[model samples]
Target: MNYTLHQLQIFLKITQLKSITKASEELHLTQPAVSIQLKKFQDQFPIPLTEVTGRKLYITDFGKEIAKAAERIINEVYAINYKTMAFQGEITGLLKIAVVSTGKYVMPYFLAEFMKRNEGVELAMEVTNKARVVRSLELNEVDFALVSVLPKKLKINTVPLMPNSLFLVGSEKLEFAKNATRKKIFENLPLIYREQGSATRNAMERFITKNKLSIRKKIELMSNEAVKQAVVSGLGFSIMPLIGIKNELKNEDLHITPIKGLPIHTTWNLVWLKSKKLSPAAAAYLEFVKTNKKDLITKSFDWVKHYDKERMLVKK
Candidate 1:
């Protein structure tokens, strides 16, 4: 029933970093001290808070739930502190964010701008896969997530950031023959693909199935960068977000070809749980996305132009 603030802080840090040594370093405590506090807290509760996998520490499910509660409690305490500081005309706090991998390419620009305007706020950001990003948001493990796909079952609020188009691309040397038809292209080349459960992979699979096309060979990869590398090496072709491959495309390391009824388009969404309370910093970020997303997309990406052209042609 009774716990020290240090205990809760340590739990939250350990859960965030998933390492005792890292949590200890952040908290200015020794590793043993961090472990002792966690142990004391766990002894009081019915379930263990953390488990060790090899040399790495993992917060257990129960520990994660407890850590979520601790985060909310800490945030509320900080809010009170912020109000006290605000009375003296000061705003200061840490903002934690988890973003899916592709968002890393763009969100940092917006975040840098936000940080410049709000000098008192500190940011902690983690770039993770879409599934982990969504799970972290669902569990209140992160303040918000910049993600590409929104889970249908979660009660969450979403602000649309930009539309992302998936492109079928390959090295210039391996480009589809100029006269090759869509069916011929699919039948002729091996396909480099992101692993299952990836948003890109899901979109690509849906398009392939809908069109009833069987790729010549499928090579599964783990990262967008890896897929690009594979395509650049002429290992195979891949479907990837246009934003992810802009530099390569520009450098002529990769070339894109249009498939009949291709280029699956989806939106990048900023998500937060409906029931979750946002801190001042988090609220500012949400507002920033709402007001500046259009300009952000327009200035940073050319995919929007491609999509607009395609849509206009479809309308015609």
Candidate 2:
């Protein structure tokens, strides 16, 4: 049976999202358009590829196997395209990375110049919580991972890239704006948190346990943006990476709450497992960062250094 590559792409997306509506949104296609194509693709097969049970769609075991083959075919096609570009004397390949959610703010700046310089290279960055980012790196699913908090029990090499600082932040209009003690601030504001397995959440937990302070855990959000929105809405305060809340801080939507021990400092690092071999694009980026990290920081991350002055409020 002959099926178009477009159908295979749509089917793979369906396997990932598990809902036609969701897959359609991801593919930027209308729901009816996806449904019609899915039905056509199913007609070419004898057995059912997907089944709707209890009102939720589930891919059959056979469908999962087919999707795997589909993925390989799609990747092969991409390789052929890249190979043609390489034959033309251009640097071309996938440069895949997995980064923790807070890293979104810093990774883009680091990549901008590299991407500009190597216009033929393709970039795929997966932004997720720390656990998944580490898992992707551990499983060799990506060429590199960006992290502020290093993982334990993982043998890896890292190149330090940029400064990452976390501070207790609240709405600018937070009550008792000035002269509040550390414990008193905790008493006043319930702390919003990133969900479990998040680097920021882990940092917050370590701080609480180390200080032996009773923090009211107001709510848990899955992303940095969500936590920021909660804080800006006066729902609660959160410890956030300064890189992410820069705009909010500038707009007077949020402020750093200078506590006794805060503005937790960590450097962002590009990490890769020692055993994994790097592709051309990956190696290029690694070399680019190593050679130009200082210049990159000066150009794209000058504002990050301004937060060092905030460090004086808490001391080293």
Candidate 3:
């Protein structure tokens, strides 16, 4: 069929979202514009690629197969562009990483300089929970994953980047008596938590179990931002990563309520599956991180240590 790459792209986006209107929004095209392109793409095939029954749109089995081919063609086109840029001695290609939700805050700072130095490169990152990040590694879907911990079942290589520390945080509106105990914080406020399979949630669970701490009530949210917002609104307290709440803590929207065994520390690591071969862009990024991470951390991450020191002054 004589079809343009843009048609394949629109079809693929429609298949993924299962809604033409949503695809149009994602592609930054008007609904009518997307509809015209989709209709033009479908005209080339005798059999229907997509079918609509009432309100829902469905891609046929034939459409699913075509979507796979479209992805391969898109990758090939990208590879050609990257190869041409490399001939001119530039590090080029898409560097895709799947990061745990809280890692979104940490990875961007590391990426900013690398991206600036290599103008030919492009970035794609999926910020999700730990389980999805690990699944992406298993599928070889991404070049790297940023996590504070990796599952023992996965054989992977790791590059330790910086410390990831979690603290028990509450809304600044929380008030305590002059001699209030740490246990009182738990008693006074409901606990907000990230959903299951989140590394933060797992760590919080371990701490609670070991200390035999009783949570009076809890609210489960799916993301770090959600939990933080809940805590900021005085709905509850949560065990949140220090990196993700620096600004909130500074603005006095949240407070690191000093819990006895808190500020659990782990090293944030960049990991990739051992069996997956690295692309040139991925390899270049690996080298850059290895060479510059120490200096980068010192320059940009001094706030973490400074915050820790200041937190110590919040007594029992």
What are the C-alpha RMSDs, in order, of all predicted structures? 7.5, 3.5, 3.1
| Top of the candidates by TM-score | 3
**Model 2 residue pairs with clashes:** none
lDDT per model, in order? 0.79, 0.87, 0.89
Tens digits of per-residue lDDT, candidate 2, 1-316, equal 8999999999999999999999999899999999999999999999999999998999999999999999999999988888887898878888999999989988998889899988879899999999999999989999999999888878999998877888888885556546666776776678898999998998888987888777755688889999999899988888889989888888889987777777788889999999989988899899988998898788877887776684445422
Candidate 3 lDDT: 0.89
* Model 3 alpha-carbon drift over 4 Å, by segment: 1-3, 30-32, 39-49, 61-69, 119-124, 135-141, 153-155, 172-178, 273-276, 298-302, 311-315
**Candidate 2, superposed: residue stretches over 4 Å from native:** 1-3, 30-69, 116-120, 172-174, 209-212, 216-218, 310-316
Top candidate on lDDT is: 3
Clashing pairs in 1: none
Q: TM-score of each candidate? A: 0.70, 0.81, 0.83
lDDT of 2 at 272: 98
Candidate 1 lDDT over residue span 90-109, tens digit each: 54677788887777776786
